[model samples]
Target: MSIGVSANRLELLQIARAVAAEKSIDETIVIEAIEEAIQKAARSRYGAENDIRAKIDPKTGELSLTRNMTVVEEVENESQELTLADAQKIDKTAEIGTVFSDELPPIEFGRVASQTAKQVITQKVREAERQRQFDEYKDRVGEIVNGIVKRVEYGNVIIDLGRAEGIIRRADGIPRENLQNNERVRAYIYDVREEVRGPQIFLSRAHPDFMAALFAQEVPEVYEGIIEIPSVARDPGSRAKIAVISNDGSIDPVGACVGMRGSRVQAVVSELAGEKIDIIPWSDDPATFIVNALQPAEVAKVVLDEEDQRIEVVVPDEQLSLAIGRRGQNVRLASQLTGWSIDILTEEEESERRQKEFAERTQLFIAALDVDEVIAQLLATEGFTDVEEIAYVDLGEIAVIEGFDEDTAEEIQARARDYLERLAAEQDAKRIELGVEDAVLEVEGVDLAMAVKFGENDVKTVDDLAGLVTDDLRGWFETKNGERVREPGILEEFNLSAEDAEMMIMRARVAAGWISEEDLPQPEVDETEAELDAEDAFDVSNMDLAELEAEAEALGLDLDEAAEAEKEAE
Candidate 1:
């Protein structure tokens, strides 16, 4: 592969093939690099202003040099351009874009020229190698790769992944798990990014998916996709939980993952530096899945708050420590696995909470209805949570209560309505005292209670409410001291959904002149709503066939559904 003043240039193709094989790059790239080097050397040999080019015959391994000139109407440089008349003299069919090339004798590279060409070839080959590595590894993210631990630099583990290099940052490695140089290790390819130097591949041993990958390797059912791992939570070298479900009806997902006599799970545990693995069966019902997640501890009850995705789990008093685990690790992992905020309570604590809620409801009923303590207790026992429910409910519902006739129901409803009226009047006065403008109350969903809350929170005018975000009305959660804590909003007691809060804020914005009615965000048409046959819901009469097909596809409506709607329309 030498290129001295009188070296054999015929070995160009052989050199390209050898280099491409060594670097795992295409031979064509190597050949192009050599051609570029030859071009640079030829340019140096000829005058620098000449448009010199070099070409290599891929099959014959032959080299050729030529100087080219482009034919233009107006000649710019005497070296690189010529008038069309001159080009026409060389070739009769010459046009403006025609290029005329004159063959030049091969270059006899001087020592400096050889060195410069060598550097050019080396740089080109290196660039091609890097591009090859990037193309090969970019799509390998989320895959498990095996590599040798090449080195540990400043606490980061560098792995040689055969064709590419991957790094496991200090945080991505399992705790207390040390690796020696040249040791074989398996890791999860979490990310691959292109940098100035080369593609940077990020691998992780502590990622939850790493455990899932290990299980896939150990358990045939997982690899075959018969057993699906829905979620994974890892403490990294301490413990991990994986939720698995079986697509095959006869096979048990947990049993398959556990293997015969724990052999399968033990192999994965050995790989993870003895990390304990919990194989839980996944259920579509969140409560059932959460109960399965808290294994080895019996759950007395599970109450789910579907709107918030929070759960309250009541366990036996003796199983309290087991459910919580050391420093609350078990519950934390369970929350991560189930995507829910879990609050664990013992049966005794749950009983106390129930009694306290009952007492609070009873007290509210007595004061709102101006009833006796016995009547209040009866209303509370009948699940009457709010005075508004008693006021607005059908009289027959109240009369159906034990020992309660229609007359008693009427009296109770009248008192509840009176109490509500007085409360609204008081809230309105309080809002005025707090300097809230009457225009704020003009917005839809802004009742006297919400207006008073707005004033208490220093949002007195419509402009103030318009500037507030939905979180300021529906409340939000923040992480503090490594714990998620709820931050109360001004209208949190109203139990408004995020959509409802946003709508209220938008109405306020419209009323305050900050936004026009047309500027309010439009509701997206639901797929179901768009597929309805009712003309008021959706109209396909004006649409051409192609447009109707596109609309049907956009709504995700099947052909049968669209046909049925069309039939109904017809």
Candidate 2:
């Protein structure tokens, strides 16, 4: 930091080159920063209002310093602007808008001036370096990067990544994994952000993709896109499960990821601080995938509820604890990997539950149809859950039941119909007694049972129903005390899907005059009209250059200027 810049031309160029090389920025950026610094110091040495400028030749290291003034009609501030009379004294050809330049001697940097110049240069260089880092790493997200751990402050690791720095926050680091200063580490670049402090490179060792990237490194097939890892679930630093599928029919995805004697997965495990890895072959069938995800345990049967995306898996009595894993970790990882809610039960438990359901259904049929226990048991065993099903089922379905003739089936159907009529009358009475209006029933999809349920929930009229949202009828999840809990909806027991609830609410809104049917979103468009509109659209591509130019001229548009700008853009 001496003031011999003009005398030492080689030193000035060397400093600029070194700073640019070290910061990984363009050499021109370093030169501009130096120019700004010199300009600042020169302004402070001369009057601050003087419009001083400085430039340096990159190759020859030649320096130029000048104070510039603009000629104005009237004298503004004398430092930077002068009247035409004063301008003509300096330059004979000066016009009103002409600029005049006067050469100035090199700045002799004082103590304060030198400090201020250093600050300006440092700030500009730092800004350029930050921008370079952001530009370099912005598109590098989702890739693994290697860096040396710089320091650990309050459990956050700062890494020196050669040209820049990155951080692995406490939450993003593997739990209980110790990272020491100067230690080499590999992390996934999950995010790169331009922040006030600089570019923040957020690295993560706990991200599931970290394991996937490690596999790509260790397995050549994965790296070459021959094998695909569709999903990964990790308990970071403890255990993980990855689902893999092979594009090549002959090669096994699991075997490729496992390598010879598990060397491939072991390498990833070592990097993750000895986390156990389960490599399972992925299947298009979710049940097969879930069964595979829960490694070291066998599932006896899996009943999938596709609508709700839930699967109930029944295991042998001995495999209950194993299937659930230690502290539910096995089932939890399986659920995450398959993207489904899984309910696990032992064989004995499932059998007991089935018997309980059968008994309840039998009792329901007996009470509703006023039939003998034998007939009711026959109906329940044949999968009849309600009187409604029996009343409308084919005559042959019940007549074919053991020891039942067509006459007995007819009698049963009559009883079922009579029972339903009586039930509907009682529910209507309950609905009216609960203050539910007849207008509510007029709304499409609203039956007596639903109206009664609405009245019980204080929704008595069509207007009241119209004011409700989908979540009010389909139930919603809430975060309560650190756990996700399901809050019961008004029609929770009705098993309404979100679309069904929304349709009912919209119908109510129309009946209640809250919204017209036409006001609702029309998701469907007539295909014939859509095709005609497409065919009728005017496309500029059909016009030749001359025709297009004539059209633009007709509209008073300058095609030549636009064509020049378009050429420049190209």
What is candidate 2's CA lDDT for residue 289?
88
Q: Tell me the tens digit of each residue's lDDT in model 2 across 26-55.
A: 989989998999999988878789999998
lDDT of 1 by residue, 1-570 (tens): 435522555678889999999999999999999889888988887888999988888898777788999999998799999998888888899999988889998667777888888899999999988888889989988899999999999889999999889999999999999999999999999998889998899999999988888888999999999999999999999999999999999999988988899999999999999999888999999999999999878899999988678899999999999999889999999999999999999999999999999999999988788889999998889988899999999999898899999999999999999999999999999999999999999998889998898898999988999999998888788889988788998998889888889999999989988889998889887877656636533466677888888878987886567666666766
Clashes of each: 0, 0
- Tell me the whole-model lDDT of each prediction, alpha carbons only: 0.90, 0.89
lDDT of 2: 0.89
CA RMSD per model (angstroms): 9.5, 14.7
